[model samples]
Target: MVVLTLAFVSTTLDLTLSDHARKERGWALSWSVVRSWRALTAGTPRPRPSAPDLRTFDGLRVFCMMAVILEHVCWLASLSYVADARYSELTRRDYDAMLMTNSTLVVQIFFLMASFLLAHKILQQRRKNLPLMKTFFETILNRIVRISPSNFVVVWFVATWMERLGDGPLWKPLVGGEAAVCRRKWWTHLIYMNNVIYPDDKCLIQTWYLAADMQLYVVALLATLLLRGRRAAVPLLAGLFIFVTGINFTLACLWRLVPTFVLHRPESVLVAYGGEPSFNVLYQSPLGNASASLAGLLLAHLHHALGDAGVRIADHKVFRAVSVLCAPAALGWAALSPRLLGGGVPHPMAAAALAALERPVFVLLVTVALLGAINGVKSWWRTWLSHFGSVAPRLSFGALLLHLSLNKALLATRLQPIQLDRPHVFFQWFGVGVLSYSAAIPLALLVEFPTQRLYKEVTELINKYKQPTQDIKMDT
Candidate 1:
């Protein structure tokens, strides 16, 4: 409930500011304010050459990361005092309600949006003599370097702590045993393939999404390469989406037939595939995520095509109104659909309706919102949202890594007992959330920033060496 409330508030603020900015100021001034508000809020000047528009995507990325963090924190807190069975039925009911409401599908919207924006930038850069392979390889390498170091640090901490605290053999089916597991399959994590085999047993529980994202990245890069020309891009992307969706649908059917074959067992089938164990086929399969990634690719292509026309569709009042309406409508359907039908008996029509209201519809709504945001939604609320969006990339990825890890640490510590029934629980959670953010700020400054810089430096050094050798060969 806290998480939802916060999300609602933040979103409302964003919209309100956007509308105000649009009404009060011209597009140029509104855009300027939106882009530069972070600097103003931070008490600094907007830097020269301006921050990259990719930064806007990063802002959204940070928001998603924060949402995931909150969801996990809420889950951890609910299960914290599970050993105490003395709680009332109402307490248990509340706990279940909180858990249900903490779902992270909302985060997936930002993920898809980021994919779209990033793919757009990648395609744009490709036109300027950039080798597609080099870009693709570099992207993979950067993700590895950026994500793995902190991840491994957390894994090491968790493994050591759990072993000491449990004081017994730690179950490690994937790695054969506790001691040998880290050494053997750690490389799998480094390469982001851990989800294929070790879906249930993760090093850092959230890293599954990292692996999924990496897989999506590879597929997107390939698609971008195959459909580089203007005329071929849309048709190719549409074909790819259909192909991937068909594969996902087929896998979903298979998983329904043989339930255990899916990764993460039954739950994976439902969440990933869409409910029945048969859905597991589609659920565990990376193709669905790849389809969303492709959707993002298409969005990028659309942006470029529209950009060439020098017209901003987002600026149109009708488009903005439609995009704004989609989000609430999707949410309303999601909230009421289950209850209206009564629980249990799952008909095909009901299942299909639920699936329609899930991630894909949410993704479309998010895409519309983003388009409106970018195309000149002038308002103070938008200015504020755009500001947070600007700061998002700088701290978001690191925050995502640290916040959940901190929550785990807190759980492991077994802090002072607090009554969840009390209103103060919200304040306590907020304090913890703030502390997590505070810790993440420095980690972002020290670890994430330095690591990214080092990766860039290494790439530059390699390129320098390769360039001279290439020049020498050409002279000969």
Candidate 2:
């Protein structure tokens, strides 16, 4: 109920702000609604530090995390009909479409922002004399430790439960059927190589994002190593961006010419297409995601070079205002361009144009939002958002692992009917929300927490084992 209400209210406020007549009133009402919503949902603001710096980058991270959570919540609510028959009558395509689009866009924004922040951190660490290769391995290892442990627990639970529920034989082929692929590839998931094989595949739901992120990190790390310091970084990144953009445009053209390239394989198409050419471009394509990471690294380099002065100028009021306005406008363009090109049967030229427009527009919007959020406006609301951003788990990788399993679990148990057919949809959504949250939290605490600890321990032990050999060589 809380998630649905907040989503509805926030969306309503967003719509109202778009209307000139309602602008002023809407702004006021929106804040008021947010205050009430927070009170109802979280119940008592977390004790905060006075004059908290409200780290903008952290705030953006939190936003991404929450956006993903909300996206999952919306998805679960939408799927409530799978478990229970009552929800069948209540399902609405339009509502589901809206939820899916909004969730997808939000997740994209999160990825873009994350890429930028991570790149900046990586560059900074390199400057501090950290071995780039060592840093890269550590980074990937850390991510695995942080994400995989909790995730594995969830997977085990869901898989075991499904077996009990009689969904199918425990070991089926891992890559086909509606839910069959996930069942089969359970081991592939454990190793985190799912993205390499089928980058855009969503059979295991959110797991696709985890695989994509890992692949992009590897690519970005390699590019950074080859490019070296600040001098080579910009051109290398820029060239790579252009190359990826071209590839995407070409793919989009192919998609248009041979609709079969996309339509024939719906699952593969969504996974592979990603508004770009090449199979699995969206999921496994280094261009789309790596560019954002590179952009972020550039920003971080600029910050180090220019110090606060540089950051201040970039975050100047005028620059932020412009970015804020432009970001949404760019996103709006990307979203509506397909329709403007003509919905049903677009001309080849029009389709190509639309496809070409998508990559740049998405990149621009994401870049601007990152800049603005990092150094735009500060207010109580922004502060609150920053808090959530700080506290939300860096467990997206883990969350992705668990999401599909949980969805299947819910489906097998027939729990969705309660939400689907209830007289008050919000109430039903609340119940499912509780169930999902209950399931996720424990897994997070028990499995994820210990796995991260073990990762650290293992790393330390390896370092100790290697140190004595170095000492012996020195004595020699």
Q: Estimate candidate 2's alpha-carbon lDDT, on a 0 to 1 scale.
A: 0.49
Error of 1 at 472 (Å): 4.1
lDDT of each model, Cα atoms only? 0.53, 0.49
Quick one: best TM-score, which candidate? 1
Query: Candidate 1 — worst ten consecutive residues by lDDT sum?
Result: 167-176
TM-score of each: 0.71, 0.67
C-alpha positional error of residue 92 in candidate 2 after TM-score superposition, expressed in Å: 9.0
Off by over 4 Å in 2: 1-102, 163-179, 196-203, 257-279, 283-288, 308-311, 326-338, 376-381, 394-398, 411-434, 461-476
Cα lDDT over the full model 1? 0.53
Worst 10 residues of 2 by lDDT: 257-266
